[model samples]
Target chain A: AQTVTQSQPEMSVQEAETVTLSCTYDTSESDYYLFWYKQPPSRQMILVIRQEAYKQQNATENRFSVNFQKAAKSFSLKISDSQLGDAAMYFCAYMEGGTSYGKLTFGQGTILTVHP
Target chain B: EPEVTQTPSHQVTQMGQEVILRCVPISNHLYFYWYRQILGQKVEFLVSFYNNEISEKSEIFDDQFSVERPDGSNFTLKIRSTKLEDSAMYFCASRAFFGANVLTFGAGSRLTVL
Candidate 1:
């Protein structure tokens, strides 16, 4: 079984600044996918970004990016030029490659607060 | 972009009662899934359906729980006898046929068992 861990319980970042949320996972499989999802106060889960284990280059979506270290089993999310809307509960997820299609194991989650 | 939609945004029921949560996945999506998040807990996968049958299910999906795609667009999760522990937010998600597809989730239906 694969387990994702988000060590940071709560994080705060000033508007227009950058912040990073840490994530680590345990998986023996060589091929897998990692994702970061954001759940706002409304409780709607939204995809932030995703990274493929085979890719060496980190994935970036607008202001959201990830620092993926496969060897260390670490995948951290970085939000640049953060805005007030970035405040939410962020979750790190892991999915193993193979017959499994959409089964994602998620972390406990990190609450992000954007300060103006 | 098309998104998944769930009906009965909130449902209140008594223990031992039967409840069905309905969802309409994205039109073009081929894979559908159901997940639940207990208050203050991480979302947990319940079951995954593809090609009109269950492809995978978690231990949490016991005999009391079942999933069905009664029609082309509608996907449903039925609980035969609800319990207090069943109270949680149930989410319906869908993904396209392409490999390594990302899931699109609905707003979720909050189920409260009294």
Candidate 2:
């Protein structure tokens, strides 16, 4: 079984600043995918960014990027130029890659607060 | 943009009563799933349906729970006898047959069992 852990329960960043949310996972499988999802007060899960284990290069999506260290089993999300809209509960998720698919194991979550 | 739709954004029911949550996935999606999140916990997968049958289910999906795609567009999850602990937000998601396994989720239906 794979388990994702988000050590920080809460994080705050000043507007226009950068913030990094930490995440770590324990999985024996060599092939897998890591994802960061955001849930606003409305509770809608939105995809932030994703990283494939095979890719040594980190994945970047606009202001959102991931620092994926496969050897350390760590995948952290970085939000640059944080805005008020970035305030939400961020979750780190893990999914099996190979033949199996779709079931996502999520972390406890980190509540992000973007201060103006 | 295409999105997953779920009905009864909020539902209130008494313990021991039956409750059904409905969702309409993307038109072209081939896989459907049900997940839930307690007040402050992480989202947990309940079940996944493919080809009109359940392909995967977690232990949380017990005998009391059931899922059906009764028609061409609706996917529903029924809790035979709800309990107070069942109060949570239920999310419906769908994925296209071909993709990086990205799932689009609905806004979620908040169930309050008293």
Specify the highest-DockQ model's number.
1
Off by over 4 Å in 2: none
lDDT of 2: 0.94
User: lDDT tens digits, residues B9-101, model 2?
Assistant: 999999999999999999999989999999999999999999999989999999999999999999999999999999999999998984556
Expressed as tens digits, the lDDT of each residue in B2-111 for candidate 1 is: 99999889999999999999999999899999999999999999999999999999999999999999989999999999999999999999998859459999999999
- Residue-level lDDT of model 1, residues A1-116, one tens digit each, is 88999999999999999999999999999989999999999999899999989999999999999999999999999999999999999999988787775888999999999999
Error of 2 at B105 (Å): 0.4
Alpha-carbon lDDT, every model? 0.94, 0.94
Q: What tens-digit string does per-residue lDDT give for candidate 2 at A1-116? A: 88999999999999999999999999999988899999999999999998888899999999999999999999999999999999999999998975458889999999999999
Candidate 1 chain A weakest ten by summed lDDT: A95-104
| Interface root-mean-square deviation, each candidate | 0.7, 0.8
Per prediction, fnat is: 0.74, 0.76
**Residue B28 miss distance in model 2 (angstroms):** 0.5
In candidate 1, position A6 carries an lDDT of: 92
